[model samples]
Target chain A: MLEWTRGQAVGEIDTPALILDIAAAERNIRAMADRLIHGSVRLRPHVKTHKCPLLAHKQMAAGAIGVTAAKLGEAEVMIRAGIPEVLVSTPIVGRTKIDRLLALSRHAIVLTVVDDVGAARAISDAATRVGQKIPVLVDVDVGQRRTGVLPGEPALALARQVATMPGLVLVGLQGYEGHLQHVQSRDEREAHWRASMEKLTDTADLIRGAGFPLDIVSTGGTGTSTFALEAPGITEIQPGSYVVMDDHYGTVQGVGFEQALFVLTTVVSRTRTTDVIVDAGMKALSSDSGPPRVRGIEGAQYVFAGDEHGRIEFADQGSNLRVGDRVLLVPSHCDTTINLHDHYHVIEDDRLVEVWPISARGRIR
Target chain B: MLEWTRGQAVGEIDTPALILDIAAAERNIRAMADRLIHGSVRLRPHVKTHKCPLLAHKQMAAGAIGVTAAKLGEAEVMIRAGIPEVLVSTPIVGRTKIDRLLALSRHAIVLTVVDDVGAARAISDAATRVGQKIPVLVDVDVGQRRTGVLPGEPALALARQVATMPGLVLVGLQGYEGHLQHVQSRDEREAHWRASMEKLTDTADLIRGAGFPLDIVSTGGTGTSTFALEAPGITEIQPGSYVVMDDHYGTVQGVGFEQALFVLTTVVSRTRTTDVIVDAGMKALSSDSGPPRVRGIEGAQYVFAGDEHGRIEFADQGSNLRVGDRVLLVPSHCDTTINLHDHYHVIEDDRLVEVWPISARGRIR
Candidate 1:
């Protein structure tokens, strides 16, 4: 019945380990590559999902234009791993952080986004110190009212500031409609993306009218990659979760991404019915997206036992599961769950294959 | 204002790091020690909260009988660091994991709990093979409905199974009432604790009357430590969050645990209207227990911008903030937030005084 690591040496694997299906991952990688080949959109997958430079290279080989990292530390890890193009999707601020970012830009084609003049000045000053012109993107508040300037005049002003800077290039405008990514209903998600795209396209027009040539209009995640790529003026889409689909992504219709990633947990207990506690919990997989789903186990609820244990109530009444049994749990949020571990086990056909180090697993800074 | 150092060095620490106010930590350590002093209750703070052996030593110095770890790796870290007594609070399953647990018991006084006969049998077999008798605590459901046997005949049956094993010692029971720990209402929490205590006390008596001499009866966390100590038959209270109170702990009444741990993040961007963005977000501090609260900023909503950025919307009237200003964010859940980092900074009076390595930072195994 056990499949993922069937004939392989499962001897040295520690409990609460993350196992990746190499075959499934390959299928997922090829699926995205096929999409990139057919579509005109530049595939700049966000590295924040896997955070493994090795996996980042897999995406680059599959024809991704660049990789996007949420933090400078993550970008540093990718750069060290020899990934060609990288973007610190988040803004670089403060003299110390700016200095670090400038140092990175000297070696790599690093790009960053900013919403205000204060942040723009910090990036400009850092670039000037390094004697280089840094590429900058003006973040527009399309619909996700978090960071970024308002879509019209404010976005234009920020883009103009970047264009006027002595050591900065206003490459494009970046805006993410995060709220629309996880809309459960297809009609609702499409409607939400349409509204968000209207704002983003309008902001792109505004920046272009402000005497700046916007080379890129970047946005979107795995949940709405298709919808985002089809947007009027968007040139690139940042879809991270497609690399490692989770339970939340499992709900998406026709996404074509396989459930390649799983937290391979050991059954620690089996008594009092078919109750089994797995080694993965809130610590191994994030509960922020709510509880995880048990793979291939219908009518079973994965209840969190503690910080490091999850109680999976089996579907079959009083199932004969015992201690030491390894079960797979689909993570709710692939990005956060992957960040919690130090390594990943690449499994094929229930066999222990290879272990990939999550080099940028906890590069939070 | 920050105060205290972990080791000896003193300098400006890199921003956006978890800092332990060592002095305040010492005081919290002493307070828990004093409360359990001259009493039957032994203090065994859960190491999952801090994950620092240095802080674990501080707990032991303040009269903690032992430390409780959520994983075997954490227990190994503490045992290797010279802490003699440790209990793997979570269940240990899998042959590889059981081997590690058996190996650990050779060096330290290792104990673990099991709510299932299958787990107890596995432990018995492992212990038998090692020619050692490992202590096992019968875990009771205790109203949390996470793990553990129901506190009636079910728990008695598990205890009997433990007693039947020559290689296993049925030392006592562990009933962690986790749901009571975060009961927002004081009366509700106390009332819930009373109900849970009655059930646990009844179960403890039932096991004792069944001719088993129970050595330890542990329950409680930071929120209900005082109330748990008041429980009729509980011999120890396992409180961990008090030493480093997160924003989640602030909801508990009379907790007396100051917000000692803060994510010292610098302002990445400042809008004209004084809206600010910080370097830390989901990767830095978890939003599972909800969004983080700004430590000293009044009337500011700390909205989560993305996985790597947090937006602080300051009241437009008090717009004195600028880029480079550092703000401390009280994490929603300290345990998960601390796990997301590799190292912590110990600060004193606006300067990074020392650095404390989170040695067991990613001990998922």
Candidate 2:
């Protein structure tokens, strides 16, 4: 089925290329924006998902209050691209990162999180050195055991410390219910978020009781957007995956996001008895989470990832596939997959439309 | 630790920067060449690991016979830099990649592998269209179910087809014992290589017995370098990881490669209750293989990973780290870790020497 233009076929493009859908991206963007508008929570999109300034601008244009970055380099690129409001969601450690964060504050409304008193001291010292007071959010570790201080008095103490610090302004509390973001069952996810939000809200109360005004209380992902918005004292939600849903997030029940992003690969080789091999594999689609599902192919199982080849097995009639045939693969995880490519080929109606660079694709620093 | 002086001190340098030891690199390059010279196999280091033309040139200067590439784009970059010989080790399929491979035949001693007859025919046709007779090697599948055809008649038949096709030169067999490359035990790896190389040698024998000239019998890796050199038929060894040994490869017994690469991250904060958090995590160092070993720090464990922070725990000291401390992390896997960065900050001890661009860092295409 040659539905696309001849030259627009995947066989015509080079291997390991990232293919994006502008229409689908626009749809996903609008969907997230519409949800926030109908809900009570303000949206501060996490730009760490798609580290492109262009994508950040698109999110800002679609009614997002600010963009959140996982790295300072990412925030720098966003600020350079004229994005005035950005949040460095990840903790800023090291003098180099703190310096960058300090510099970023001069350019935009940059916000960072602190979980420990020492980290708060570091941020305060950096701000004092730069002669600029930076807004600090107490990161409460609700369920995601990765970072953030434990909820309750511990988080409240950090928030109080920030308020007293000379050059640091204790603005709010930021907690991410990351563990609930990928839970398949919506009820289970919501139940988990409700419990987590209770702790964050309790922490917020303690911080407020400590004579500090908490302006922003951000928590939740695309999976628990509605629950977080309905929760008491929560003012914002930072959801990243809703804009470009992967196989993992797309399967979340009751989530409006569709599996819009896919890696377009061509069937390069085939064996008579075994299966067909596509040009996309571990490098094209990350396997850190799990194996990708071949989109729309009946009873076909994808397995055996080489550096560049993906072996696909059909339940019946393996002979039906041949060289030059295009296949769409649903990536296991969207964030890591997007980081693998230099640019995204924006396709619309099976035709070449535009190309957007993953401008901050490899901005590790 | 302040040795080299390219610019700033290691403490002053930014977090999550790739640090390469230039002196160690030169020694590693010569070490691979020396090992190959003392053995029977010719060294054709895979440039896919480093993706730097300067490093490729250094490999050849250190007596590597040729360079191997994982993609045509890398081969093109290397060829443009005047590296005369190259082998696109992966199968060249899809019209665009085939066309690029065909075009590569004009300027360099281009060689590629073919596991399927259909791919061989396509490559031959593309080469014939460009009026160039490109050399082809039968990629024999030896243990790693990733790519290549099975040894014996399946491979011999493909070799026969390649010989029959116009504009194609059927070279010998190419089989990589990739599974052996990471076998923790040297004895176990050698045994596996001995078994796999026997099958590949027999396959090479079948082709040569059929009156075909088998010149290049390429195989092996840094883990199985010595084993492959001693193989009866493996004329060349492709060892890419030896140039910059990773923590994973460094643990291999009798493999003299040093831990020359590290992710220079700085601690931004410290706590009396917990280990310091550094500004480098999965985004800086890949966790695909496992957590990176903290070089020279005994009883130290790399705990919880965020997108941009690696929490380090030293069991005995119970928080010996302080703010602004520089931590050098030995990556678990070098190949994937290098792919995470844009440039390599070549350092001798603690000072920056030169920043080498990972030119083909994301050259999956």
Candidate 3:
């Protein structure tokens, strides 16, 4: 998997390469930091989007309190990268993950979210066996009924159990408004975002009112971060995709972040006059959200050609696409797209600056 | 990244693991070999599906003539693993990929398909510079307008040019009917399959009549292997996914291969009485073609919960799913799903077996 080295031109780099614009990404990170500087909420950017320790370090340097990880393997990578604070946002079950989480706690300040008593007890037992006190947050289901308990009583009950559990400290609550992230309208998104935050704060208050220490109230993502900062009790925000905005997030109104990530591909084959094929397909740019949007190619559409190739269809018959021509595509989803590659070709202007290994990539365990 | 070691129970393996049923996959390899043994077309199974050299060796031991790769990186991995013959089915453009392809030709009997003159000239120039005569195939567009020239005079012209070009040998023609691979009805699929072959053979005859020696007429996939074996001029079939069946290809009517690949996951969180959340989501099981199908769990449907979780909705409220229960899911698309993992946990009768590294998993250049 040897790709282009530093000082090579962008066009000279290999096809289907994950290219990150350093300037645009720095601007995105700086803008998010500026937005939350005066607010009560702190930034704890999720590492699952870039999965790069270098980028996570940039986020931490830009005023993030910590980083959020979706898996224990990712947290291990971040902790090995010398990140001091990391919160595993997803619940861990089974002895395998719990053991690994306990091992990770030896090196870093690790916190995990849990929605069930069985998982919480498992973590508590593992932490006790390792002679460590692990922090835990009660994951509350705000709108996305994926992995969380109910907001009010169910969350408070779990928090109470976690607070009393040996070798475990009850931190706060995590109520992610995942469904409200892509609501498509500012008014609708704000209305649902406010309601979701109110539910989270109410649960936080219920847990605090039950004479338990609730130090951290974490929530929000790239879509709901602005509204979540204005909410009453959200102590930190976890916006992952804002650093490398995708085509799906680019459509969200009021997000001033520029698209910073692209899959640089070459026109490999031209079948018809208007239909040119590129070297990137489902393996390069994920089609989970939708097909990636072609950057700066007017009246051109990117379609899935195969698992290893993509078709760029032009509306005009007089298209000038030829073999060896390079094109840029904004991925539909940044998280999954980043998971498919091994390294990122960090570019400044037209030159490759660095090739950072996606340290947490394929760390699904 | 320390997953379950060999000799562990299936339930004890880590969550979100790629599980390969050894017995079922062997049977699938044998079935495809049996179909091609007595026919005019020989089996040249594509390695892009499993991306494992061990599996490619199994296919070769089961009477496959060679292997087909979708990229030069995959061919390099296979050749390094001692697979003697490999045909890169996709066109290789740009200097970086062509240089790699030429380097691979020195180690094995390497071949690649070309649809345009520019790609052919580049391959020819690189092969000449490396002092190697690389085998080339004229990729004819049967129905997939993704990467191929037309199957008439255009293919003959490209074949002639490749034959006369320095350090390049025009060995055959490849016409893959990729669009006809997934037609629902058998009659409709066979109808289009026969037409695609007719076009392929017609192009082969045209190329031969134009004084070019056409040695191989290769085509077909897992969906159209049976029809392609019976096609008049198709001397070899390139079926990749039959060895490790997926949900999308399993729905194809007559492909009798058993589902061999599964994402082994554990129940991490359960929100509702019928809604059980597993540790596999978009990053575990690819949702590109569609959501994965749960194996053996009656009346249960898997839906995308988040990046790290999947919601299993049971039609009946009497669900027995709980935390730490393992479930196996057949991926919608095996190629992209395999790209997300680093190793395959091979299993035999619920006992742990060999853990094969997916050597070419991320070899997408």
Go through the candidates in order and give each one's C-alpha lDDT.
0.80, 0.79, 0.89
Error of 3 at A10 (Å): 1.2
Return the clash pairs for model 1, or none: A3-A350, A4-A349, A4-A350, A4-A351, A5-A350, A5-A351, A6-A350, A6-A351, B2-B349
Question: What DockQ class does candidate 2 belong to?
Answer: acceptable
Q: For residue B324, what is the lDDT in candidate 3?
A: 86
lDDT tens digits, residue span A282-335, model 1: 789887788888876777789887677788887777666567777777888898
TM-score of the A chain in candidate 1?
0.94
Highest DockQ model number: 3
**DockQ scores of the candidates:** 0.52, 0.45, 0.82
Pick by TM-score: which candidate is best?
3
Q: Tens-digit lDDT track for model 2 on B84-192?
A: 9998888787776777777677788989888878878887887787788988888888877656788888888888888899978987678988877878787887788
Per residue, candidate 2 scores C-alpha lDDT tens digits across A187-289 of 8888888899999888888878878889999887778875654787898988887777888777788888767678888776664456777877666777667
- Local distance difference test, candidate 3: 0.89
State the lDDT of candidate 3 residue by residue for B1-365, as single tens digits: 66668888888888888999999999999999998878788888999999999999999999998999998889989999999999999989988888788777777898889898988888788788868888888999998888899989888878878888997888999988889888877888999898889999999998898788799999999999877656788899899999998989888889778999999999988878978999998888788898999988899999998788899999988988998899989899999999888999999999778888999988887
TM-score of each: 0.92, 0.94, 0.99
Top candidate on lDDT is: 3
Which pairs clash in model 3?
A: none
